[model samples]
Target: MNTVKINWPNKKSSNCSPGVDWLKAAYDADIEIPTGCLGGSCGACEIEVNGEVVRACIATVPDKKELNVEFFSDPYW
Candidate 1:
């Protein structure tokens, strides 16, 4: 199976297959990505993937060979 490299903000990285659960991948990398609702309604689990904001709860790793992920912080959250 093909895999992609996810580069977290902490300089840590992990390899995962395409379409894998992003939250699980983040957890495997020891990266804490807060989530309020796992149903993608609360928007608390928002994150930036390849410079685009996506809800980690409902999103999966893309087919890209490398993904740069960063936490999307919201003061209101």
Candidate 2:
């Protein structure tokens, strides 16, 4: 399996199986992101990857190269 390194907004590094736990990666990144519901319906774990908002809870983990993700705390509106 390929190891994927996720670069978070706060500059933290973590590893997880592809399409597994993207949320844990963000939390390990030392980013104080918030989520109302752990479930993937509340839309609270939304974050930006370059410039797009991706729900960390549902976002698939990277499988090949490490991905760069910039998360927004209270990023809504």
Candidate 3:
């Protein structure tokens, strides 16, 4: 199985298989991605993947060689 290289917001890196849950991938990288709803209703788990913002709670790692992820910063949060 091909794995993807993830560059987390905290500068930590981890190798996870494609299609892996975003939350699990982040956890494996020793990073914490705040999540309010696991069903993708809340915006707490929002993150930027390869410059595209996505909800981590309802998204998975795409099939790519490398991915750069950034946490979404909400001023009201």
Candidate 4:
């Protein structure tokens, strides 16, 4: 299986296999992705992957050569 290079918002990087959970990937990289719910109900775990917004709680590391991730910041939250 091939691995995907992930560039996290915290400036940390991790090479993870495809189909891995986002939370796991973040954990492996020693990065914390805030989460209000383990499921996809809340947007607290929302993150931008390759410019696409997705809930980290319910999303996996997609199969790609490299992915740039950014945290979704809520000014009010």
lDDT (C-alpha, whole model) for all candidates: 0.90, 0.69, 0.90, 0.92
> Deviation in angstroms for 71 in model 2?
1.5
lDDT for position 19 in model 2: 68
Model 4 C-alpha lDDT per residue in residues 1-77, reported as the tens digit of each score: 99999998778788999999999999999999999979899899999998888999999999999999999876887
lDDT of 1: 0.90
Shift in Å, residue 8, candidate 2: 1.3
Candidate 3, residues 24-55, lDDT tens digits: the string is 98888889999897899989899999889899
Off by over 4 Å in 3: none
| Lowest-sum lDDT 10-residue window in model 2 | 68-77
Q: After superposition, how far is residue 54 of candidate 1 from its true place, in Å?
A: 0.6
Q: Rank the candidates by lDDT, best first.
A: 4, 3, 1, 2
The residue-by-residue lDDT of candidate 1 on 1-77, one tens digit each, is 88999999999889999998889998888888888879999998899998899999999999998999888877885
Best-fitting candidate, measured by lDDT? 4
Could you tell which candidate, 1 or 3, scores higher by lDDT? 3
Kindly list the per-residue Cα lDDT of model 2 for residues 1-77, writing each as its tens digit. 77777677666767666766666766655666677787778877787766667887777675667677775556355
